[model samples]
Target: MADQIRPKWALVAHGGAGAISRGQLSPEQEVAYRDAMAVAADAGAAVLRAGGSAMDAVEAAIHLLEDDPLFNAGRGAAFTAEGRNELDASIMDGATLGAGAVAGVTTTRHPISAARAVIEGSTHVMLGGEGADAFARSQGLEQVDPSYFFTERRWLALEKGLARLGLPIPARPTGAPQDLSGKAALVHEEGKYGTVGVVALDAHGDVAAGTSTGGSSAKRWGRVGDSPIIGAGTYASNKGCAVSCTGAGEYFIRLGVAHEICALVRHKGLSLQAAADQVIQGELTALGGDGGVICVAPDGQMAWSFNTPGMYRARIADGEPLVVGVYKDET
Candidate 1:
């Protein structure tokens, strides 16, 4: 009977999480970030308002972000140490527990759409590298040259990373270092850490989540982060909620941040807000990982939490004005 009843819809999204201090951004830049959040939120909420599935809503929202160069997921993805871009994405449908993902992919115009194709067309849960690109082509997804991913801003970040390591700019893109311990920390601290994600609750009460990223700046050896890992960065369940995370991939994977929130709700009887806070504020902070997540519950409740100084995020529920913020203080 509960499943038969239509619920009010809600949608939420995040650009990324990190030390986004007030003085770091100009007034115009702040407005740009907030405006981007509102656009992303409106895109997804529009689908929900039209009685679309949560899966569709989440995908629609992420598409808008991926197209925007302001975020670090698709067009503006960070460059590897070798100055190349390798994109990753994942999507999940909570109603059926079906999911799809792609990693180390290049040339696929929209990695999220490829992920959706994998869910709808294949028996596999994920594909990577050349194989994923081939599949995307077969599905008729838009394809682009790898050069299309290049952005001057991300290239500068790579240069900064090399500088932090006391390494000279190589004559050629020799790829990143084998071990990027200190280097990765420098990239994150400089606010180059980013990802894009969305979660939605549809009129039918189903929840879905999706995430996309370009991996870490100056990363090497086909490194994959939490963005494309289903439970680590994205999860959804009709019985609980949908979660999309953006943070240090290793910590999120080890802590199972995304699924942990859903598990807390299903097994521990915690509300969506409490569950998200426990993971983002408690476990993640204790582990020294700075990031955040957007969550939407089956009951149309929404929650977002981050341990960092700021997270680019927005939320909208039925009949409510969009609420967008980039700093912790605003929320």
Candidate 2:
């Protein structure tokens, strides 16, 4: 008789955290994003079903989001106030506590690949700015034109943010200052948008976490935030669970959101849902911070918690996995 075989696993992903609202996105755009999310979730589920590591599944899922221009990460990243494109990303394995990250890199085609390189190649846990770029080149990772990140939508968004906030329009030394107040005012006049991330558990019950982002629109130089930091933007532990977050990056760093959620499960005996809720509503909100997180436990349970108005998230589990693209509170 053939050997019996079965596998159980789960995956969760988030596009970002911010003032996302359904009113701002058209019905056509919503469906397109949901379709993309489904493809990403399936890619990850296939790896998990084949007995791949949670880390592998999470990374696979994120690759799709990274390539999607609809989200502000990887290929579609937003420009900084100075009209530059710098990206940051990180990945963590709960089983080994092995973590890697890259920040302030402009040439690496995929920032996450550089992060993985860091974990596999170095004794250190983090690398940032130009040093991170040099490391990516040394590792022989693929490179892309910095302009590969340019998107008309993101460019307009940057301008809108600066003008509304009364900041100067960054000008090129060789060119006259471009008029952008109109563009800035148009994209963010309503204060609506967010980021992307993923958390996963494999058949072996191992946990993994990954987060990728283009950084804040028009951010100042060298302003590295939480995305490239393990505990702040992402965390995972096979002993409990895995988590990926998006929101106010500074507050997430201060609260150590991802690690705290895992800790709640390990130390306070909280369920995945309970832990995430406590962190988003009880801790983050209490601290006067706003954001959200997507998480998964070894048992295959998943949760998306947010104190903000909405979180662009998706989950795959059981016989019927589903993607959630709405911007309002699901609760």
lDDT of 1 at 39: 93
Candidate 1 has a TM-score of 0.92
Residue runs of model 2 more than 4 Å from their true location after superposition = 1-7, 171-193, 329-331
lDDT of 2 at 60: 86
lDDT by residue for model 2 over 139-221, one digit each (tens)? 89888777666666677778888898798876532322344342222232113334568888877768899998888887875
lDDT of 1 by residue, 133-238 (tens): 9999999999987766655566777788889977665343333233333212222232656899999988887899999998898887788999999999999998
Error of 2 at 316 (Å): 0.7
Alpha-carbon TM-score of each model against the true structure? 0.92, 0.89
Clashes of each: 0, 9
C-alpha lDDT of residue 18 in model 2: 71
